[model samples]
Target: MTSARRTAVAAGVLFLITEVSAIAGLALYQPALTDAGYLGGAGADGRVLLGGLCELVLVAAVIGTAVTLYPVIRRRHESLALAHVAGRILEAALIAVGIVSVLSLVTLRQDGAAAGADEGALVAVGQVLVAVHDWTFLLGPSVVLGVNSLVLAYLVYRSELAPRPIAVLGLVGGPLVTASAVAVLFGLYGPAAHAISALPVFAWEVSFAVYLIAKGFKVFPVADRTVTAGGMRPELSVA
Candidate 1:
């Protein structure tokens, strides 16, 4: 296994981690997110804390994918590779902000419950925190994801880093997701619309991750040199 192939595998693993953690975190948070009295309810603390921790892992994994892929993809296009890294970082930061909001809500719930404060006020605060989290989700995964995916897909397509089919998924999905986000922002559609739009990008990432792990990358001849699909010189590239 060459270093570049190893890096590709690592990136794939990180992508899987991000996906699993995001789903699990959201699942763990569902009770608190939906229940009006979760702040004062029994066992809410544990659920919220677990959810927050999962989200933290998700943030790390998100950044990890970008960092691991940077070296491989940058060979084809430095600026776009850097932009993908920056976009992933911004996504992680937004997710972290959302985590903070949730944690703060948890703290408020605990304190308010102990102090016998107004339940209405606690509920209101919780609602605001959830709203903040939702917005971050929109901006981070929806908007930022679109840009990052498009950048990556372009690099992959141009360099034949992975299969063209996988790259095409990203190309198609990125715009769909961004458009869906716009619709949501403008109140033209609901969660169902957003969910439908997210499917393509979701497919792209999952398929790409699997491909990278199982096959690494392809090879191509460029100009006077033979390079790996990711655009690294043949001697430097490994699969």
Candidate 2:
């Protein structure tokens, strides 16, 4: 593969890392632990801390994808055909993280109240904010992640970089994600909804991670170069 193709693949891989990290560190692993309710007094505080740290990783992963792919995107602007797809996906990533932050703050207040650590006026306000944040937080990230997953899947398929099966996985991920988000919005919660929606998401993400690491970059020749040679033609140069 050419250098530009390599770079694009590299950027994609970086983006994939953040995707996997968010799902693994933030969504699946941490929640599994927290939901178990094993942390006790330290549970709330410790969970938040760990969650925050995981989010930082997510941020870094996002920034990494943006920066890494930016140059590649610029160079291949005519051919990428899905730059906006990446942008939408990134937006979803940020929203997912923001939702997590809001949820943590809400839970923090609740924890504080439980601990009798409430101050005067601040505590009362905190309690109110806690409820608002909690419910909103519950649904926001799910929807955001689901929407973005579909977008990413589209990008993957359109780009045609990875194997066809992986792209299919990405495509299937979209509806699964959408269903999960809708379920949550419609007052669905608990393990059943979580598992049904989340398993597909997790599967898609893990598959993407595997493809990025294993394949890295694959340069596929675009047809219709003759048409591309015309002024109106799409540029198909690699590297």
Candidate 3:
């Protein structure tokens, strides 16, 4: 396969990893995030620690998706491509912070129990940490993801990298997700409502990823060129 095709496959894999690891991490965190008695118990929950590892993977994959697509995307629009990369990096950083918050809960559990700290206070602190993680989730995955998704969809639409119909899904989805995030932030909507709003964006991403992996980029005029440091350059021909 050509370099562009290779980049597509790599990006698809990273997007898949980003979603899978995020779900796994969140599910694994339940024992710590949900169970109030967990932190007050004798020892730290291993699942929470494992969740942290999964989120670390998520962080890596999030950034990977941005950087992997940067060269191809920059060829179409350089400034927006830079914004996409920066946004993903910021999103990944927020995810890392959320991971740290969850992991700190585990630490609080172990040390608090060992030190004979008040159980009520410990649980309250755990709740605060979980809340921090939840806020980061709202900001990173909901708001930031939405903005970045919109930017990418616009790029793809303009470049004809994928079908315009698929890009439309993102065009619509991004604002919905962001608006829902704002609503949730202000208590106008719940997380469940936000999840429903996010479905379109999810559909857009999944469809895009699958298309890129299977069909590669659509037939375009730029096939003679190749990616370079910040943009694409014409292929060097050896005479």
Candidate 4:
């Protein structure tokens, strides 16, 4: 495979990893969020730690997708390409902060349980940490993802890096996700809105990933050159 195709495949794999790891991490963390005494429970420690590790992997994958795609997309639109890199990095940073909050909550629970601390205070702290996580989820995946998807979709649509259908999905999904987040923020709806809003973007990413891995980028003209597996050149055929 040429360098550009290799990068595309790597980005696709990273995108898949980010989605799967995020889901897994959230699943592992759900028990702690639901259980008031999870921090004090000895059995829950392993799950929490594992969940934190999964989230860390998710963060790395999230940033990796952006970095891997930067060179290819930048040729089409420099500003939007840079925005995607910045947005993904910021999203990963927010995710890291959320991870810290949860890990700290776990530590607090363990220490508090051992020290015979007040259960009410421990639960309160846990609640605060959970809230921190919720906000980060809203801002990072909900709000920031909307902006990132739209920018990426536009680039793909214009450059034909991927299929037009895939680009359209991003265009439509980005705003829906963003609107859902705003509604949740204003109490127009509850957290369930996230699931509803996330579906389109999720579909877009999965489909896009599959396309990149199986078919690679479509041949398209960029300025006076054609983009192919070999990178931009004066003339090239689809590879």
**1 versus 2: better lDDT goes to:** 1
lDDT of 1 by residue, 1-239 (tens): 87867987898899999889998888888767788778878637788789999999999999999999887777777788899999999999999988888788878877888999898888888899999988988888888888889988988898888899999999999988988898898999897879889988999999999998998877531333565778865333333
Give the winner by lDDT. 3
List the global CA lDDT of all models.
0.85, 0.54, 0.88, 0.86
User: Per lDDT, what order, best first?
Assistant: 3, 4, 1, 2
- Find the 10 residues in a row with the least total lDDT in model 1: 219-228
* Model 4: colliding residue pairs: none
Better of 1 and 2 by TM-score: 1
Model 4 alpha-carbon miss at residue 94, Å: 0.8
Error of 2 at 185 (Å): 0.3
lDDT of 3 by residue, 120-211 (tens): 89988888999999999999999999999999999989888889999999999999999999999999979888999999998998898899
User: Residue by residue across 1-239, what tens digits does model 2's lDDT show?
Assistant: 76655655666576666665566545533442334332223345555556556656766665565455444333344334355446445654554555464455546556655777635643455445444444433444455556656655565565555676776775776667667667666777664666576666667766766666567645443433444444565555642
lDDT of model 4, residue 165: 95
lDDT of 1: 0.85
RMSD of each: 4.4, 5.5, 4.5, 4.4
| Residue-wise C-alpha lDDT for candidate 4, range 1-239, written one tens digit per residue | 87777877898899899889999999998867777658667648788889999999999999999998887787777888999999999989999988998888778887888899987888888899999999998899889988888899888898888989999999999988988998999999898767888999999999999898988777543445767898987642234
**What local lDDT score does residue 188 receive in model 2, on the 0 to 100 scale?**
73
- For all predicted structures, in order, the TM-scores are 0.90, 0.63, 0.90, 0.91
Predict model 2's lDDT versus the native: 0.54
